[model samples]
Target: MPDVKFKHVVSCSSEDPKNPAANLVAQEAFRKWKGVAGQPSVSVILQLEKSTKVRALDIGNEFSAFIEVLVGKSTDTEDAYH
Candidate 1:
């Protein structure tokens, strides 16, 4: 498996500062879920220390009604997701 880690929140459409983006990377099932009041479409960007080829992802849908995954290389300057 790729050694993935949360780098930073590049941008968020909406967020509750108290419940931050870091919560998405918690090890334990902590009460840390990033929230947006009215916005249904939100975006979060995560970075990897080194290059990686992601095959699959496991995201808990406890809070989000729907979710989408996008992958890109570190060198890309724009949000050109694959």
Candidate 2:
């Protein structure tokens, strides 16, 4: 597996500002889950230092009725995500 570097959080649909989406990239396994509730759906946007093909993703203890993953090229504009 290639070294994966998490750059930053571009956006999130709903999150407890206190907890923050950035917690998802915590280096330690002791980090708590980034919680978002009272919403029908939630989304998170993350930036990577380099473009890479995501073969797999590991989500911690969180519940979602549905999950969707969309990959875009590094050169893609903001509109490309929507």
Candidate 3:
């Protein structure tokens, strides 16, 4: 199966500038997105070139136990993600 590449990072709940959320979508995919230390949970909103249904995902875990993925459309308003 082909990989789903993201168009860009829409909004990130919390991220360490050193390792930005955008790195997760980078073509290289060498870098990882890191949240600021002490945060309980981090959320990220990403845009795709078109609508896509993800059947599988390949991830390299570091210190995380579980991951959640959310899918939605983007509106013109700031609260586009729903």
| Local error of candidate 1 at residue 18 (angstroms) | 3.4
In model 1, which regions exceed 4 Å deviation? 25-31, 63-65
Ranking by lDDT: 3, 2, 1
Give the alpha carbon lDDT tens digit for every residue of 2-73 in model 3.
878788987899999888998978889475888898777877887988888888877565577777765667
**Per-residue alpha-carbon lDDT of model 2 for 3-79, expressed as tens digits?**
46778777877777767787766665554445567778777777887877777787664666677777665588764
What lDDT would each prediction earn against the true structure?
0.68, 0.70, 0.78
lDDT per residue (tens digit) for residues 1-82 in model 1: 7446665556666557987777666655663556576767767776766676667776666456778888887788788898
Pairs that clash in candidate 3: none
Clashing pairs in 1: none
TM-score, one value per model: 0.68, 0.74, 0.75
**RMSD of each candidate relative to the true structure:** 2.9, 2.6, 2.7
- The alpha-carbon lDDT assigned to residue 14 of candidate 3 equals 94
Worst lDDT window (10 residues) for model 2?
Answer: 27-36
Q: Judged by lDDT relative to the true structure, which candidate is superior, 1 or 3?
A: 3
